[model samples]
Target: MSADQLLDALDPDQREVARALTGPVCVLAGAGTGKTRAITHRIAYGVRTGAYTPTAVLAVTFTARAAGEMRTRLRELDVVGVQARTFHAAALRQLSYFWPKVIGGAPSRILEHKAPVVAEAAARLGLGVDRLSVRDLSSEIEWAKVSLVAPGDYAVAAAAIDRPPPAGYDRTTVARLMEQYEQAKEGRNVIDFEDVLLYLGRILQERRDIAETVRSQYRHFVVDEYQDVSPLQQWLLDQWLGGRTELCVVGDPNQTIYSFTGATPHHLLTFSTTHPGATVVRLVRDYRSTPQVVDLANRMLSRTPAQRRREGGIELIAQRPAGPPVGFTAYGDDEAEAAGIAGRIRRLVAAGTPAREIAVLYRTNAQSAAFEQSLAEAGIGYLVRGGDRFFARREVRDAILLLRGAARARAEEPMVEAVRSVLSSSGWSPDPPSARGAVRERWEALQALVALADDLAAARGGTTLVDLVTELDERAAAQHAPTVDGVTLASLHAAKGLEWDAVFLAGLSEGLMPISLAETDAAVAEERRLLYVGVTRAREHLELSFARARNPGGRAGRKRTRFLDGIWPEEGSGRRRPGAVRGSVLTGEHDPALFEALREWRSRVAAETDKPAWTVLVDATLEAIAELKPASVSELSRVQGIGPAKIDRYGATVLAIVAAHR
Candidate 1:
């Protein structure tokens, strides 16, 4: 394709980017804006116009997947020989090429994961070394390295940013651990992933001959996701540039969500100041989501604290037509929230929405258990992203093996009872662990298996232990166990760069969304941006919900996320009020006397049953019952939250109350 043909396929801003083929250019691209298209076309246009030699052009991004995408696009445009790779990939390549000539025979073997080394270092330092602690320490080490902080300077640098030490360790201890970790790596003769970048930067800085060779080969550079560049990455980019200004970078400061991994937007925000007379283009036309989603995304960022908000953030403009109104809901507890989301998903799937285009995103991986259970119970297939698969979990695997063995031994107990007995022998407990983390996660996975057994028996009468095992095997096989065909369950951080037709942002409470560990102002702001990323992932349908408590009978002390203060229904007029019961619409009117009577009866029954009042019937459902005045079991079943189970349990009593009111 000719240069003119490439420019013809781009929008106005993208065309402007393509035309600026000879200078330092920065594109502040918003979410869903075709920034990839813009930058790739710019490279193609430059190559077609003979402004850049295809072999000398290098495009850098943050992820290998992203780099592969760029290569694919460039290949389709018939522009070949451009080096498209991640920062680490590029550094590793350069390090391998120059290592033999500079200081050694061969480079050290690369460490695949820092956890084992981190654990060893922690043990040597006499620190507690649980799985979570080791993981946290590994993250802290990566953050310190990427921020260009040395072991000796870690304490002061960490304190300057109010960065808390991981796993309850003090700053001094963490600094010492960092030093010990380096020594351990050196002793093992292995370089970590971060060391790949560090070593390459040092070689480029110390060896002028090597630096010139690299600089001469890659004359033009294009960087994607520039806002997520760490200080070390920027240092490497500078070395690659060798003081030349032939560069084009693209990023959106508002979408910067990886700060916990040492990413910062300062580089992208200050690019123009560093390189004067740079051609800056703002890509605000969002071609992915509808106008409603775009507007919510804009407002979500606008309401961020002034100190935490991005300066000169780009506001997204919708390029698509209107979509469904964004949904907000509150549930009595986590189980209800999960079940409600599963129900809505079932309806959407029945109404012609593909299951693969739906997602239930949360703030943490530990939150996946409830949704996984609910989806399975509802017969909806799902795939967990950035975490272990439901059936792939160790606890689930162990329980299934135990059940299969028990079935072979001809256990005489009922299906659910026999399954519970096998699981109990393998450490399954009736109550959840008091704390959260790996232990709690294990329990939840086991509980899900038990629930699966109960559901199978209830759905199919006289289900034997053998039958339950067969059902498990079939589900494990057909749930798209490790594929992308089912509904996605992912953490917000993991959902970046991915979009869907329908998105349910679950667990939108204060502590979980902002996360209790996000103590600093900047950290909280990053959390807000994380939610913005989740909101913009939807093309049409979006729902945000939170449960009042963690467990069904637990205290309802949690509140909605403060980030939605002015945007939520209670805070804003002329908007749909958030439903107290999932999938229920409120008329905001009810018979006062009947509503009170129903609440009283709910309290009495909850006290007798040792459950929460909402478990009997939430206020919204009671209000719905009062207003609608359902007088029969059939009529009562028509109310929201009144499914077959509830109807069988409370239908007659509810109808009797309505009769008395009448």
Candidate 2:
């Protein structure tokens, strides 16, 4: 389907970027600017125009999900024979094909043992064996390698950043740990993630024939999220483009929030310098957001702290008022905050926002409890994002394991562990006091359920793997409802590749959002990008909320976000007051005592004005009134959220002193 066929029309910039197929084009596109569209369409147009064979073209993204999504879109566009994969995936494929020839042997087996190698290294570094998780340590090692930081260089970089090591180890230990990890990975006959790039880099640099073969195979290379290209990724790109190869990289520098992850915008911004004759393109039209949302995002970008000299900062904001201003409510505690958000979600759903269209975002996964409880109480459905979503939950994972195990007895050991988790989580109290002989014996029988699955499937004449998979899916189908309604609770990382009707960015406090540690230059820039990514994901309404404290008395210890300052920039930006956050909220923290006070005030105002409660006021306006103690309508509107529609509606009566305080 063309751009015009989609529900959302593509802007001129988007159309041009999407259709452009000539030369070394560098698109400095920001989030919500139809970047994904630009690339997919570019591929489609290339195929249609006969510039290159789809099979000869290569598309690379940062993640597996991104690669799959791009491939899906290409297939939809009828662009066939193209290969799309993560950088690692592509390198691995190339290496796999050539590993046997170069070394006169099969591929190294060390790669498969990355976990055990990391574990051993961590132990030597004095890390707490139980405390240091294999998965987390591997992730750190992978990130370091991709950033081009070797074990020898790890200490210097760690010192430069002054970042603490994973709980059990300090700098010296981590540096030593990484070194040991490198040696172990080598010994295991498997090259870890870093080795993939190193091997590929070597191929391109040491051997001209290999480099030329790859270059010939891939006529064009398209990179997504180009600003996040790490040093090693760039080196790989350099080899691929040896001499001159058509390259197109699209990214938003302001959205470059992964410097800590070893990603940098230096290459993205300096593309023309290094490539020479590179055509730099900047996209300004944001096809994703409505005008109001756009105005807020652009303003936020302009006011960001000292930013690096990078291309693709926010230029055009989408202008649409598909929804109301973002609602902000301060809660006395985490429980109250969750409850308030959950309650609002129920109301939002009842008012027509589909649960899926709404998303509840917070700083950490730990904060979802209150909201989950509230959602449960209201019968509103929601899904937590990331592996931590349900699997990370003790109660939920236990339940899921039961379903997976019982459904697929022939399944691997993960199935048995699932059942075991249920008993343990349900408090079997393994001690003799809690374990009856019958219960213990039943548990033992359950342990052998995997054998039962295989026997059952075999007896039923199920021969293929698909048969067992089908039964498993069937069992899960009979489980709880899969799709959630009302809102999705997710972390920012999990929110990628998703768009929605409304997005709630909760907990925009200083310590949480930019974080206190983000006081440095690079860290602050990343924080800005993180906020930008959150803002651009919204298809319509975007709510940015914050609280002074988790508890009113918890801390002198609390602060509103600096990002909020950008939203309601008090001083004019060469014009009248810039657009402020769009919703209403309650000012005081959640309290039953204040609820009555708030309700009584609502009743008196509703009676005199004869307007619906919402018309007379909304959550944000009331919160503003409470915070500013506005004596009149003029002052109220002047307070951040009250806009013209509000001023014209109930301007007079709202100005009256509420209780005629003497």
- For lDDT, the strongest prediction is 1
Off by over 4 Å in 1: 303-310, 390-484, 553-555, 571-662
TM-score of each: 0.76, 0.70
Per-residue lDDT for 165-203 in model 2, tens only? 553345566667788987776676667777887898898
Compose the digit string of candidate 1's lDDT tens values, residues 487-599: 99999989999999999999999988887767778889999999999999999899999999766656899999988875676633323532233345556466778877886
Misplaced by over 4 Å in model 2 are 1-10, 109-113, 124-128, 133-136, 161-163, 304-311, 319-322, 389-486, 551-557, 566-662
Give me candidate 2's TM-score against the actual structure. 0.70
Candidate 1 residue 643 Cα shift, in angstroms, is 39
lDDT of 2 at 397: 42
User: Of the candidates shown, which would achieve the greatest TM-score relative to the real structure?
Assistant: 1
> What TM-score does structure 1 among the candidates reach?
0.76
Q: State the local distance difference test value for candidate 2.
A: 0.63
For the record, the alpha-carbon RMSD of candidate 1 to the native fold, in angstroms, is: 13.5
